[model samples]
Target: MSERIPVFKPYIGVDTAKAAVDALDLGWLGMGSYVRDFEARLGSVLGVEGERVVAVNTGTSALHLAMLSLGIGPGDEVITPSFNNIGDFQAIRQAGAEPVFCDIDEETLGIDVEKAEALISPRTKALIGMDYAGIPCRLDALQEMAARHQLKVIHDAAHALGSRLHGRSMAAYGDITIFSFDPVKIITSIDGGALVVETATQVEALHRYRLLGMDQSARRMYTNERAWTYDVADRGFRYHLANLHASIGLSQLELLSAFIETRRDACRRYAALLAGVEGLRLPATDFTDVAPFIYYVRIAGGRRDDVIRSLSEAGIDTGIHWIPGHNFTLLKTCRRGDLSVTERVGREILTMPLHSFMPAST
Candidate 1:
């Protein structure tokens, strides 16, 4: 059989395994010192204050808490792109807010700020922008638009951990910025994510919110202690990241620079190899400030299905980045504007194999 090229394979090494073993030896596997350590390291990487980064169990939890922290709730509306993962939509709905889907820019494939601005209303509380395929949405323009309308901006930086815009890190924008460390992401903490709050007060609230509303629970966790008697100030959830997962995240952080270079190189290689292939539309290869998470191409001439089948037969795996949220039964009833670009992209987008661990021979 020919060597299989899967959609993605995480870069795992001896250092990652050793870090997990170290956490195992520590015996306190809950949200302990290691989680704090990971958060501090991540803060350094993003150039944010260490205490401002709140580590969570998943990126969805981060988004959910972010909306709630910003006081978005029932009867409020948040604008987002339909060319995004369903998690953002679910997070808005979970916070009792409506998600107003917008279209994407044909070139960058990121949210269309002009379309989002048109959809805003008195009830629009915030705007959520995703870094699609590691290319950041025009955050400055979006933030300016939000400011003019007195709305908050939340950045779903799930695909943009190591990406940069105008020499600043992706986390430097938005009222709140979030990251994902799922297995297929640029880095993995086994399964973990984080939210970056701008103010100390908000950070404190996020710390408590992630630990089931127990006030100052993060301080206790850092010292390997728990509060036997605690008071719930407001609503919260058990969403804090565990030490075991954070340990793995720390290991991944150590290799982030190399991982980014490898992925960027692979993406460039794919662009070079697949350029001018019939019916394939490739993204621009200007990755000077971006760390791409996926290598995607647009299949024109209604040949996406045939291309996928051919690749499968050759032991190569592929995928679609997303299906528009409006297509989902659960979210079909939500408010939305014109999704022409979103629908078009959904039909043509195809994700090919790209990862840091691929064989150099390829």
Candidate 2:
């Protein structure tokens, strides 16, 4: 049998394994020097200050913390695209806020700023715009609309860590930007996430919220030491990233530029190979300015399932980026704008195998 190709794979190396083992041997285990080092290096990569970044246990936790730190809660409504990941919706609910689904732009697959603005009302406290497959949303437009309504903007850059918009890093634009380093993401920490905020107040709030609302000094913890006494002034969750995960992340971070280049090359190759196929809509972009997380194509005439089956038989795995949030039982009644584009795209989209350092045969 021919080897099966996975739809997603991490680009881990021997160095990455060694880094994790070395961290384990340090015996400090939990959030420590390695985590701090990772955050600093990540911030440097994003061109943000060290003080503006916070590392957490998962991408979901990053979203939850972003919502909480922004003071979004019961009676508040957050506008988000119905085409987004379920994690974005759950994060709003986790903060006791309602999610108002909006449609997506057919081109970028990101939020439609105009449609999202139409969903805003007196109760709207924030807007969550997610980058689709590393394609950035109209963040400038979203920010402008949010500014008019005095609403906060949370950028879900989970798929866009290495992506740049008009030559500026994705992290350089949004009010609060979050990134994921899960096992299958562009980079893996085993599993981890980060948030980049603007102000010192927001930074301090995120630190507190990710550590059980304790007023413990992060500076002290970064050195692998903890203060004996601390105060709890608000509710928080156990979301801090550990040294082991951070160690792996640090190792991955060192090769992020190369990983991005490799993925982009694979995506370009896919585009070249699959171009001109009738009834298929290839990704709109040329894979420049974006660090693609997945290479997906839209199959027309209801042949998506058949294509998946045929690919499976050939030892090639495939995936679906998501099922529309509104289709889920829990989100059925959520207020939403017209989701015509989102619904159609959801049904037709099929993720193809693409990995960093992907073999030419694949």
Candidate 3:
């Protein structure tokens, strides 16, 4: 029997472990200097200012904070792809806004601009576009649509840490964008995320939203201090990233380029190895622009299930990218536009084993 190839895995080593130990040795583990330094490092990678970044405990928290920063709330509607992690929908709902599910582009596996445009109404406040499986959405087109409709754009770039589109950073688009550092994402901070803002104002708002609306808490924490006497101007959450998590993130960020190369090579390898496999269709590769988090293939002719079973027996693991959000019981009654692409993709897309640490032969 061979080793079981996981659908996703984190690349960790002595450096990462040492980072965690170093944080513990500091004797302070909350959202402090390490978190600030992580945000600064991430900002440098994004070619943005450190003040424009807000580190959070989870990618979902980043999404929720981004929405809240934009003042999206009850009676507001946010258009987003139905074929995405449930966290996307939950984030919108968590902001007291309604998620208006939209269809996805079959090629990009992201929100279809045409379908999203058709669903817009007077109540629409924003659009959330996820970079599904680390492939960036047609962001320029989406941005144009948002401008025309007066809607804010939030790029849910949870899987797009090292990805780009047309040589521009994935985080460089949209009004606000968030990246994930979860165990299964492009990089792991042992569970952390960060939101990128376009303006100093949104940065401040996000800083407050993630720290229980405690004004200046983020800035204070950056100096290894706290807001002992502060004002809570608005609603917020205790969603700030901790020093321990940031330590891991810093270690991982240092090795991000190498991780990107490995993942990119793995994706290309999969494309070559599975090129002639029947009933399997791989996405067109654009290594120059995409830093894929998962190498998913579209299985056709009803062989998806059988292929998964065979892979399982062969010590390989597989997963479905998602089930359409509209199909969920809780969201079944929610408003939705044409989900034709979302429905079809949901049935055919299978996430295969593709990770930074994966063996070349895998």
Say which candidate scores most in lDDT.
Answer: 2
Which candidate tops TM-score? Answer: 2
Model 1: clashing residue pairs?
none
TM-score of each: 0.98, 0.99, 0.97
RMSD of 3: 1.2
Please, what is the whole-model Cα lDDT of each candidate in the order they appear?
A: 0.90, 0.92, 0.87
Where does candidate 1 stray beyond 4 Å? Answer: none
User: Runs in model 3 with CA error above 4 Å?
Assistant: none
Summarize candidate 3's per-residue lDDT along 173-288 as a digit string, tens digits.
99989999998887789998899887888888888788888887576787777766889888878999999999999999998888888888888888888899987888876576
Which pairs clash inside model 3?
none
235-256: candidate 1 lDDT, tens digit per residue: 8899999989999999999889
- Kindly indicate the candidate among 1 and 3 with the higher lDDT: 1
Clashes of each: 0, 0, 0
TM-score, cand. 1: 0.98
